[model samples]
Target: MKKELLVLVSLFLSFSSFTQSRESEVDRLNSIIQDETVHDTTVVNTYLELADQFYLKNPDTAIYICEKALSLAQEINFLKGQSEAHDWLGYLKKDKGHYDAAVFHFKRSLSIQKTLDDKLSISNTYTNFASVYTKKGKLDSSLFYHQKALFLRQSVGDLNLEANSLNNIGSTYHTKGNLPEALRYYIQSLKIAEKLGDKSSIATGKYNIGFMYNQQGDTAKALSYFLDAKEINEEIGNQSALASNLIHIGHIYSKSKNYSKAVKYTRQALCINNDIGNAYGRANTMYNLGFLYKDQGDLDSAYVYIKKSLGLLQQFGIKNGVAACFIGLGQIDYEKNNLVQAQNYGEKALTLAREISKPEKIRAASELLYQVYEKQGQGLKALEMHKLFVEMRDSLMDIESQKSIIEQNMEYEFEKKEALKQVEHEKEIAISNAEKKQQQLIMWGSVFGLILVTAFVIVLISRLKTTRKQKRLIQKKNKENELLLGEIHHRVKNNLQVISSLLSLQEKDITDEVAKKAIMEGKDRVNSIGLIHKLLYQDDQFSGIKMQEYTQKLIESLSNTFGFEKGEISTNIAMGDTWLDIDTAIPIGLIINELSVNSLKYAFDKERENELEIALTEKNKQLYLSFKDNGTGKKDDLFASDSFGYRLVQSLTRQLNGKLEIDDNDGLHYHLLFKSYKRIKS
Candidate 1:
């Protein structure tokens, strides 16, 4: 928005020269409009031309002409002409300092442009509205509008307009006492203009920078930049800009007390202003001349120049210049000791200063009024004037203080915003870091868990392999033990068969009962050992013996051996499923052999159908074996004697880790109890 205002101000300044002839130009254009029998579009164009010519000098006339043009365009539905007329109307109103009206017209123009899709004109309207706000001192609003203009222009690749906006914003900052901010924007503008080869814009930015530096009291730096700007303007043949730069440099020299150099520059500026017919510039140059002469103590020359400057300023409606001239005249009168005239002049200056809101001029006039009253010997009046002087001085000081405070607040707010942005950025970085760490931990955790599972699988596989190996070893040892037992059994069986054959032959030759009985007994012992081998070889698993099966087979084989199958003796076997290791199996087998032989020999004494029973049971890791029979009762004294069969039974029972018992009545019963052997696989 400020940018647009600057452009407007530049345009106003540029066209200021036309103000002298503007009425005549408008009149001539009006004559042309009246004489032409043109179409609506041509008529509108003529009216717009006349409007533009009269805009600065006769805004009301310009407005009238623009409205006529607008009506014609609207009647014909000539959008382009309508848009142009609205823009001109806005410009006319803005030049007349009717900012609100100007804004309304500019907005209307902007809407039309948008409807027409005229991007360039839309930007222009935005800039125009921004300029109106800036002139009205609505700086923030102006800035907003200018930014809009800048953005649109930049989007359209209008470098010149973008730079102009930058410079305008800088100028606003300058007015707001943001020197550093202003300098930054100015430098940015300068860089863009330089890159675009826009010498005029570059020169303008340089001149602004120099002026800002001058205002900041950096005269040496300001002078350097001004010289650069002057050089560029001269090279580009921009006489008006060159003259302005020269005038500013001259003022700086004047302030530095370089009167001779000041005079030289001021004279050159004056010549340019006169050639260009710029009333305002001419007045400014004249005022500078007055100051130069006044500083040099040439009162006569100062008076003449100051009066001329005052006349020009009044004619141009330059209020600040008029106040300054009045103050100068007051100073001259006070110096001359013309107290009444001095007081009058000072009051006049004070009135003008207040009207224009020029505080420095007010302060100057107040001080001069106090001096004038002091010289006139009016002590009370002088004291009052002194008080007024002090009040004005203090008020100016307060204004400066307020301006400083405002500047500080703005700076602090800016810094605070920047700090907050930095903190937010850091927080984002921290969050990002934390997320990255969490992801890494999850990744590593998953990897470690997989490793642990893989290791457990490996251990389980190893354990299974070891178990299989141990089982194979045990099986092999069991097989070898089985083979050894089988061999013993085969040898025992062979010896038993030979003994039986010898007995048969001896029975044929000797025909003796005692010899036959001895042979048969020997044969029975050998057969008992052979029967153990038969049970051992019956099953593939040789870890332990099946006691019930072994006992049953032994009893049946013994019945066949004693030739009891056709005799009147019957044997019954009862047992539970019980198994023992080979260590216990051999002893138990021998014990069973003795019991069975005795039962067959003595149990059926009368041969009237006798019964024999054998039983084996195991519980709680203990084994029991029993034999019973029904026969003619044997005398206790006869069984009590140590017979070979009885001795064999006792020895075998002792070997089996068992105790034996016997009962005699109508039958005999024998029992043996033993600790069962627990098998441990290799």
Candidate 2:
């Protein structure tokens, strides 16, 4: 069950990945190919990339796959895809050493790229052509193409590719025997690679440096650099690079006459090439191994190895490797005393080497043929081969070439010393400029700091003057406001007294007792609010009035209005320093006034002692008020009265945030428990 579940999970994950890849690759490709707005063309390019991975490892299968991609691209009228396929085909052909076929493909790719106006791709195609030309021993053509690619790459500002182009130009110069020029370009390329931190490019640069030194006969330095490059390639696991490094190292060993070590290195390179299916690399390594065997005097082993190498070379169409292999086989036959076979092999080597226009190969083949023809008793043929051998050898080692090399080396060294001196001079100038800049910065900073401090002091002094002026204005405005409030309050109190005087006069002219009583009640209500304003205007705190003093004043006014002597009403006041703002106090005063007047008039009798008890206190944040009379107690129906005073008292009590209850058993009693309005004390 667990195994089945694991299988199901794996299938689910794989299906999901496949769906996503299909969406991104195939579906996106369809959109790009159909839509002119889209510039990206990855699907066909990706197929070519996939082919590249397998092509070296399994050429037959990868070629078929790549060809299928090309066909599909052509069929679909995908120009970019066709262009990419052509470039990839060119690379594969170049790697296999089919120069003519490679050139044909690169030319096609370049034409397509130019038609598409793809500058970068056009530059890459140029590079590919250069690589093929370099392998074909056409130094002038290789250098021309490399320079063209470099220009285009630089125009596009691709620094990484610019470095690659520089390296390729350096390689071309090296092949042309311009070691100093090659080293300069190599150093330039190396600096860019170092800046980019491209390890692969750095390794290639080191290898090129080593190869240049090897050409200069600096074996120790060459070996050190080669080993350094080899270490990096090994660490990076670049199998192709590792194979190349091994082959170069093997060449160095062979030159030093260390045949065993040479054979070992060549064999290792051969193994790498075989594993990676690099036919050209394998062929070259095999030929080197055969040469090592020849150096060790192992004729049979040399013949066998060279024979295998010649076959691979023929299969790959590598003329250089094939020519070298033929020479090796010829030398082995000559050393074994097989003159006729040696002559045959030597003749084939010369023909092929001349056809390829490789002067070095031609010289070697001519030298070998000279000995073979002499041994075979062909006198005329021997002399002709000898003359050709001397001619080719002298041309290859001409005086001008030697002088040119020496002059370039001397120039390079002189420039190196000049560059060092220039760098030191620039360093001293940089220090002087930095010091001057630092002093200028210090001087400017001090000036800016002084300006800031002066500005702050000016602003502080101005702010202090403005603040003092504002303080005086605020104080004057406050005094005026206080005096204005006091005058207004005094006018309001005078207006209430005038209204009370008019009511008294109106009451004297009246005949109805009830109307007279109503006027007196109205006058007393007006006076109650007036007294509150009197206390307000007396102080600067326009906040609240003293409720105890306010109540005492209200009762005294009521006693005078009713013509009751102080002894006519026994008043017991229990209010503390309770202060009430005008809003709550006005309603409270009215209710107290109405109740006190009612008690003094109706709830009291001449025949009995009457007492008006009023108390206001706070408990648990609630205000309580008790007003009672030792005369007559009324019914509990507060809304039952049509009398204005009775209704006013009930309405005012309801206005407060408390309820009213009448208890007639002890006396006419009013008890209120206010849960909302708070009692404030001052």
Candidate 3:
């Protein structure tokens, strides 16, 4: 489709290069218009011709002149001049990518031309109308208008316009993937152009034929036609056409696995496109280079070029080119043994291909995914993808069918014209009588249907209201439940706090050192458990608590319990938003509390500042907890039978199904490992 646009625009440029010499033309037209002897109609004609010449080089000037001409034509009641002015304005809109406005202007011109019985202008507007629809991707509507233009041109004996119409039809067929039909129309256009000795149309016909052959896998024939067209395009200085042909040749070479030739031609095309600032041409060449590098096993180079190509294609809304880039990316990832990445890219390509309705792209993506799944030993998925690939491949024309279609396409076109004439005759009769009867039936049917529809709507609205009310009630109940759960945690934390305070009071009254120590240790353990409920009640989400914040709070509580000032111990905690469910957080919190208490009691020196470090992380389904302190190493009898706190730490780790290791060489260091709770990614 992109090549069609470029090549077809080249054909138009051959006939429409008045802009190349617009300065002299503008001067001459102005002189003629200013002469009082000249007729007003001739002056108006000069204005329109002057505007056409200015259109490509200066759209604003063109629009101004067209409006001036239109105003004069309307003042003089010149219907033909007004229609021509409107048609040129439509062309300006179409050139500027304003399809809707183009359609409006074309239709307005069409009404004026129809009233004036100007068949030539009418047919020309029809062609303009079809082109705007083509640009809008409304292929069916485009074809209808194109056919109207063709019929009008044929009737009026406009051989050149008829040939252009055929070429336009061929381009539409090319877009629809009916290459055989496209080639037939191209051949008809080529015959007409040769008869008329129109070099531009002849070159365009050859290029279109080459494109069809290229799509059909005839590289030799396609290359021969492409070179012929390329020679003419070079002579005429049609750089866009030349660049597109080069790109096609490069693609053919790549498909045939001629890497050096592919790279040379593709890069040459890219350079030409860059010089011309042709974004579409540049993107197509880049995509080919991506495939080239991928085939050469340069995955990194392939990735960069393909990603850039995808960006450009997406910018231009070229879905087919975007899908091709995804395919290239998928292949690169597959080659690099990134199976998941490959599958992701391949699936995206498939989805885009399906969206754009390009079967070949769909087949390519499915085939790639099939290979990826096969390599990954996914037999069922591989089989499913293979089936899809086969279905799309089977739906395409095989070699014999393509040959048959090409051979019969001419006969088919002739019969189609006769069939269309016959159908038109019958359609008029059928539609007229059908409409008369349909109007009467529809009048009564609407009344009955409206009654039923209104009743159904009322019932549906009532149900919708009820459903929304129920949903709101359910949401309210869920909020109430969350609040109730929070209150329960808060009450449980208060109870634990009461117990901790009682232990603290008992420790204050105790005389024996062992009894005081036991009561203090009990209070610390109760405080650790109470902290978990406090977090549950206070946090926004009860599902999990951030380990870093929780650790900081737990360490601060330990410092308070041991009466250690900030200068006595410096704590560094770094977990970085790592979260754990209460199930895991409780045990980990208690373990850290016991270890911190032991370190504060015996490991630290009173005269020196102590440093404590704690970190928690989860990766690949494993949780890591680390605690280190720059204090006196633990005593050898720390794990003795009477060491209740150490024993408690051991039992807690066992409950968590975790392993605990100690490193006491320089300072007391404890590392814990266990299976992590299910982690939710943000």
- Number of the top candidate by lDDT? 3
Residue 428 shift from truth in candidate 2, angstroms? 7.3
Candidate 1, 130-188: lDDT as tens digits:
67765554667777877887788889998888899889888776655556667777988
Error of 1 at 670 (Å): 99
What tens digits encode model 3's per-residue C-alpha lDDT throughout 1-682?
A: 2233234334544654343455466556767776778877787788888776556444756787787778878888888888988898888877666767788889889999889888888888988988777665576788898999999999999999999999999998787666666777898999999999887788889999998878766789999998888888888888878888888888888888898998998898998887665667888888878878888888798899989999877765566687889898998888889999999999999998876567788899999999999999999999999999987775564433333442353244335335434544554565465556545554655565577988556655655565566556656655765676576667667877766765566456556576566667766777877787788779845556677888888888888767887767888998997777666777788888988998888878768878998888775667888899988776465655358788878888888778888878778888888864544331
lDDT of each: 0.71, 0.75, 0.77
Residue by residue across 455-531, what tens digits does model 2's lDDT show? Answer: 65665565556556655665665566556656665666676666667566656765556656666666677677678
Query: Positional deviation of 653 in candidate 1, in angstroms?
Result: 99
* Selected candidate, larger lDDT, 2 vs 3: 3
Ranking by lDDT: 3, 2, 1
Q: Tell me the deviation in Å of residue 167 in model 2.
A: 2.8
Candidate 3: Cα lDDT at 422: 52
Rank order by TM-score, top first? Answer: 2, 3, 1
Model 2 C-alpha lDDT versus the unseen true structure: 0.75
lDDT of 1: 0.71
Highest TM-score against the true fold, candidate = 2
